[model samples]
Target: MSVTKDVAALAQPVIEGLNMDLIDTEYIKEGSKWVLRLYIDKDGGVGLDDCQLVSEALNDLLDGADIIKTPYTFEVSSPGLDRPLKTDKDFQRYKGDMVEVHLYAPINGSKLYTGTLHDRKDGMITIVCEEKEITFAEKDIAKINRAIIWN
Candidate 1:
């Protein structure tokens, strides 16, 4: 398995035990250094204490497992307000919220769309934009994320 997947598997229980969902895991190199980032979330939200707790526990588990050979910095944090909606559960949870969708190719001369996420069913997502309900196949989407409207 890939390093990210391996680390995610090892970290899943630790995060879940703390009553948080593991949003995602990424292992990437930055300036010749490897970084392992874990995105976690829960109802209401996540806080620094949650991140620190998960980080400490995962650090111990990863150190004991010796999963990665090279030196890497570990980080645990929230996915943030504009985080991508990656799974069905995420789509369901964010129903009725505004979202920004980027398509792999332009549809009707547009590659970007901002709308209210109406529903997700059978590999398709329905969004309401300008009083019209538009549906797009999940495969055609390059990215779909919550649109944070800043005041």
Candidate 2:
């Protein structure tokens, strides 16, 4: 298994027990250092206290678990406003919210779309844009991120 998956697997229970969702885990080499970055979230969003709590808890577990033999910097943070909608739970939670969809190939001469997320069912995703509902197979989507609107 990949190191990111390993880290996620090891950290999942601890994160859930703390009442937070583990959004993602990324293990990457940044210059001369290895960084283990974890994205976490909760219903009303995560604050510094939440991040600190998880970080403190995971520090002991990770140190004891020795999941990484080499040295690495650990970080815990929120997924942010533009986080991608990856799972059924995410899609359901963001239903009726604006999202930006990027497709692998153009549909109607366009590869990008911004719309209200309508539904996701049976490997298909539906969105409402311009008074019309557009549905695409999940495979066609490269990503679906929550749309960050600026005033």
TM-score of 1: 0.93
- The window of 10 residues in a row where model 2 has the poorest summed lDDT is 85-94
- What's the TM-score of each model vs. the native? 0.93, 0.96
What is candidate 1's lDDT per residue for 1-151, written digit by digit as tens? 9998998899998888998889999999999899999999887789999999999888878998999998999999899999999977688778999999999999999999999999999989999999999999999999999998889
TM-score of decoy 2: 0.96
What does candidate 2's lDDT look like per residue over 1-151, in tens digits? 8888988999999999998889999999999999999999888789999999999999988889888999999999999999998877788878999999999999999999999999999999999999999998999999999999899
Candidate 2: regions farther than 4 A off: none
lDDT of each: 0.92, 0.93
Distance (Å) between predicted and true CA of 30, model 1? 1.3
Candidate 1 ranges beyond 4 A from true positions: none
